[model samples]
Target: MLTGQQYKDSLKDGRKVYFQGELIEDLETVPALAAPLNEVASGYDKYFNADPDAINPVTMAPMSAADLRDRIPVITEMDLLTNTTYQSLMTLSVAAARLEAHVPEVVPRIRAYVEQARKDDIRITECITDAKGNRSLAPSKQEDPDSYVRVVERRPDGVVIRGAKLHISAAAFGHDLMVMPTKAMKPGEEDYSIAACIPANSPGVHMTNTTYHPTGRDPRDFPVSSHRSIPDSMVIFDDVFVPAERIFLDGQTAHAAVFAHSLGLWERLGGVSFMVEQADELVGLASLIAEANGTAKISHVREKIDEMMIHATLLRAGLEAALAHANSTPEGYFYPDDMYTNVTKYQGASQFNTMVKHLHDIAGGAVVTAPSMLDFDNPELRPYLEKYMSTGSTVSGEYRTKLFHAIRDTTADSFGGWHFVTNLQSGGGLFAQRLVTRKNYDLERARALALKAAGLSGA
Candidate 1:
């Protein structure tokens, strides 16, 4: 396994990464990329350096309910790249199993790839969302056929693909890119049904990156995001070649959706797990700020805290159910229950804004308009501001202001905006979650129960 320093050194392998229109020659030197890079590097040193004889829990296949349950805390604490790497491996495992009966030839290839990735201990980021030129049209019907990544040439050794994937997180930093079909494909759309694992530094691959890390601000003022932020990339493949061994799916339109659905299942499981953690964190923030504001004893403030506590509990219950009812593949790899995972993800995402709203209502305008920490450093102004800002002896002005800073940094600023959108859009949007929930729901059982409730049973 690579160490933290080794991981940072490996990115010097000539990957083309751009930030703010300037090609970044070294990611470690870029201010915006430094925090996330360090985050992944630290994760490698922390998790992958255990005893060589023991199985690395991050990549281990869950064999039972306890195994699945045990992964929750790790998943919640994992960095973005590490978590995505887990999702990538699990997606391949699930897809390979689903394809065993239909396309047995790909099974061994996938298993081999997974094993090699584990041995190498390299980070991988998934590239699934396409440029998707027109939302109303299919891949082949778009004005630019390259809107969706597709195979343009098939050589004896490999295939060449051309297109772009949008909103790929940490694409510029990972060692490999897991490319797959964004949606199901029809018969004539075989060229677009391509899935492969390509090197991040492969020729013709380029990434334009963007991040939410605060620029030119006091780190204390932006505590939550200043310490960590993942960069999203527009990963472009300009006729990138994929060796035969690296290609997991090619021209198999029938099984294209299998990769997408498989990825969705794992991704949503991770999303739901993170949501459970974030829900609790938000509750803690709400409670802490209320106390600092001396509103903890107010009935309405207590009610709002009560509501947030319930939200956190429900989300936790959903995650528990997903693990307890885990489903196993034919090969004995266990995954979270799809119905519970999707339903919980949907409920958490749909209600996220409302939860934030409740937090904001309790926090008041100070969340956005709070004085900067630097102001407290001013010798002359500090005394006056402290005198007015403090509620009593227990709550100093700086103490209360720090809580406001946390709230603003997490929910009212750039990082907050990123959280809001990602909470809804990541692991597919709320619509996608709804579709999966509907598909997995036991409607037949519900119908039977309804019939029994009415007087129409056996009629």
Candidate 2:
């Protein structure tokens, strides 16, 4: 990873891409991209450079080695599927043991870029998810349009890109981008399968930004919602040129799949790690809310809290499982098991939804109707809301505030309220997980076992 200064310098690599109508350059000054750079910068300094090396000295080198690159993106997409499935299972078990060591390597590289961008005030984002045209069809089979991003022309030193990458988070806010395959591409989808990092200003690259308002971003500043609300952009790359060094995968469908799967495994682990913590936070809030509502001692409500606690435990178990069993590949760094990682994510999805539902259930209608703190602070409504919202028990004013604010944020803002939707969708969405899961699991063996016991059929 480059230093913060170097990272900022790297953002200036001359690349042309269309944004709006005219070409834009030097993203540091882009008005629309300022806040995001700020947010990313804050995350980097605190998280990335916390260690002496500004990277994880203990585990980074071992984890950040070029080993993962050795897994060719050109491998058969079919094989990539198997490896992804396997890796997911392994990672879910003990994600921390395997991944924590590498944070030094991963964080600094990502952080350095983000930090410098923060310092220079340049915009940058990553694009991986494809337009994926028709849900039922593959990237190559989409009708009437380009559902997936692909290469349109091949230059000796670079390649021209076309099509759109959908649901690309932070697209509009970036000055340059790192694009890669969202999933394995099928044969004949070679153009779409090429993966590379290109400038956001690459020729013909356009972004349709989204806003997940209310809870997403700072709503006072952004107001769109649901695929909107300034969430992401539909990155349209039209004949954009990508030089070779910036190219990570080119028509190497097989290797692309491996790379994607590997990334997916790690992403699943990390995502679950964060999501689990989020759920725990909600659960803790729920308890406080219950106490304020004079329902803390209720048997059923306590039971729900217990269930929520179990979710955290299970989530940690999966994370630890992934880490405990991780191994290093020729790529030098480590990758977790597919089965455990997927299981962690899968279970997480199910449990998180379940947990949230209980939160809504326990919270009654109050979660949605609680008085805003602002309103409660008002002179007139303060008396009324504080009186009505309060349980009139032994709860203090501070305790009541804590309870009300808990539900308010969970159901309020895009970032705060839509956590479930984001978690379910961000990591390839729920159904996509199922698609990989079915491919990864050995259904035949299970079927054989059932048949043997029933004497109906056998291999």
Q: What is every candidate's alpha-carbon RMSD to the true fold?
A: 1.6, 9.2
Candidate 1 structure, TM-score to reference: 0.96
Model 2 Cα lDDT, one tens digit per residue, 296-373: 899999999889888878877876776666666554457655666677777887667688777777777765555555
The reply for model 1, stretches above 4 Å from the true place, is: 48-55, 451-454
The TM-score, computed over Cα atoms with residue i paired to residue i, of candidate 2 is 0.71
Structural similarity to truth (TM-score) of each candidate? 0.96, 0.71
- Give all candidates' CA lDDT scores: 0.90, 0.57
lDDT for position 334 in model 2:
71
